[model samples]
Target: MTRDEFMGRLRRGLVGLPTRTAAEIAADYGQHFDDGAADGRTEAEVAEALGDPDRLARELRAEAGARRWDQEQNPAAAAGAIFGLIGLGAIDILILLPIVFPVFGAVIAMLMTGVGVFIAGGFALVVGPFFGGPGGVLAAILFGIGLMGLGLFMIGLMALLTKWLIDATVWYARLHYRVLKPALEPSNNRSQD
Candidate 1:
């Protein structure tokens, strides 16, 4: 079947599911059908490869039902978990804005640095010979070197912080999946049994 047709069938099969859960299952089943078709399978073969829709639908319904019951029993915990996740994602994106858009960050940094260097150079060029001959030039040289070093240091520090934040977010997502997947499965098949 075409992708849309397959999705329609899957969506109908999962009619009782929560909207988010139904959409996820439909999308997953659609991808499965697409993969099968990519291997030169006919529509019937792809549908068969996805297996009996009724059985899949039942399993999904059971899982969702069990999860809902679990959430109901621990409403506060569920709310905290869900909102905690949303908050974390929001925080990560806010922090990553400048990091991922480094061009903008770099441009701003460059503009500031250019203005700083120009002002320092202009001062040094105008005042160097009066202070202590070559000693004045040395002082200006030292000051310029220090300003560039400080700028580089700030850039490097920001890069490291961004990398760490991104890595932490990835780790957090993987940890959440690992914990939640098994939690969603009924213990000892109690619900189905």
Candidate 2:
């Protein structure tokens, strides 16, 4: 491609960047074309030597992202960034699932047990009164019902808390890729060099 075509494509790919920043990048590439031409190379040769416009845009974005990553001091973001990089492929899944699930599974099991107890307590409250055959079992049944209600309330609270935690975990995982993107791009630069 000619210099104009290459610069146009680069500008398009970098639309998300600030106008001045994108213009600067385009100008730098334009200079590369000029320098190459002065050395008796065609525009296509300079563009090809520089690499694909799309990849360059991604790298630039990633670099910006990484810089932001440095500025933000979030522990969860750090963990997500690590996992995000690792979890791109199958090995991360293999490593993460085993590490993650055991704790989650155990917590779920204990929560379910609490719910089961509340249900059983409710059933007892319903049945114990009838089986007593019209004695002062009314008081006992009322007490049992109170206990069951309390249990039900606890379960609801637990459910809400668990949902919030799960939501946080999911959010962290999703942020992983964007955080890692900048870090990953620089490695490509090193390799290409």
Candidate 3:
């Protein structure tokens, strides 16, 4: 494909992205073509080296999502990042959806369970003294403290796990992109020769 055709397809593929972002991406790819030309390559060779514009757009979207999630760490950004990664491969969706959903569900359940335990502990701490004699009140206070500690620990652990999950997903997506990228480069070299 010529540079104009390649950029047109890329711009179409980047439709949902913010205008500035899409323009920046287009300019970046345009630079790639310029660089290739300086190295005595044709627009078609550069386009081929870059791979399919639609696939490139998808990968760029995934990278952008990952970057946004890293910056914001919000649910919306996380969802965008996850869906972008999943969109990269049908095989990934087929293999990962079942496992990912259950793991996330377990994390959420654990967090809720932790909160419930903490609340129960607070209730016990407050009401136990009212209901019981001296030794019983002391035992209830101890139990409440123990329960609260356990709940806090569970919450902290879950937070760490959630962070790790996001990091792993980003890593996997980047790894997938890197693995495919070199396959295109050799063709560019062969075309040059």
Candidate 4:
């Protein structure tokens, strides 16, 4: 593809983006073509190196959404990021959805279990001395303490796991882009033919 064709396709694909944002992206890509020319590469070579304009636009949108979510940490931004990532391909629906849903369920269950245990511990601590003799009272206190500690540990572990899951999703998306980029390049298709 020529530089004009590549730019036109990219601009069309970026229709929903803010005008200034789209213009900046276009300028950046235009600079890429200029740099390629300086290195004695043709417009077609530069366009091929950039890969499909539509795919590139999708990636840029996803990346921008992710960045917005990271910065704002709001539900709308997060939803946008998620939808953007989902638009990248079928792997998310076919593979990630199955695994992520179960993992999310497990995390929620852990949280519930932690809260239940903590409440049970509080109940034991409060009612222990009323139930029996001194020995029983001491035993109750110890057991209550243990239960509360266990509950706190579970809650903390769940938090860590949640963070890890988020980090892994972001990492996997970036890895997917890197791994698929070469395959998407037009030069790769010509070489295969």
The runs of at least 3 residues in candidate 1 whose Cα sits more than 4 Å from the true structure, single-residue gaps closed, are 1-135, 184-188
Tell me which residue pairs clash in candidate 2. Answer: none
- All candidates' TM-scores? 0.38, 0.44, 0.74, 0.61
Tens digits of per-residue lDDT for model 1, 49-149: 56556545655664454355345534343333333333334555566556546754665566567556656655655565467755566776666566566
Cα distance off (Å), candidate 2, residue 93: 3.7
What is the alpha-carbon lDDT of model 1 when measured against the actual structure? 0.58
Model 4 regions more than 4 Å off:
1-54, 65-83, 185-193
lDDT of each: 0.58, 0.65, 0.84, 0.81
Ranking by TM-score: 3, 4, 2, 1
The number of the candidate with the highest lDDT is 3
Q: Per model, how many backbone clashes are there?
A: 0, 0, 0, 0
What local lDDT does model 3 show for residue 57?
86
Over 1-193, each residue of candidate 4 has an lDDT whose tens digit, in order, gives 9999999999987887669989999999999999999999999999988888988988888787778767875557666666777777556468788888899799979988988898888888788768885678888888788888888888888867866676577667767877886765557667678
- Residue-by-residue lDDT tens digits, candidate 2, 57-99: 6556544433434455354444433343343534445766786
Worst 10 residues of 1 by lDDT: 79-88
The window of 10 residues in a row where model 3 has the poorest summed lDDT is 183-192
Best by TM-score: 3
lDDT of 2: 0.65
Once fitted onto the true fold, the runs of candidate 2 whose alpha carbons sit more than 4 angstroms away are: 1-90, 133-135, 186-193
Q: Name the candidate, 1 or 2, with the larger TM-score value.
A: 2
Tell me how many residue pairs clash in candidate 1: 0
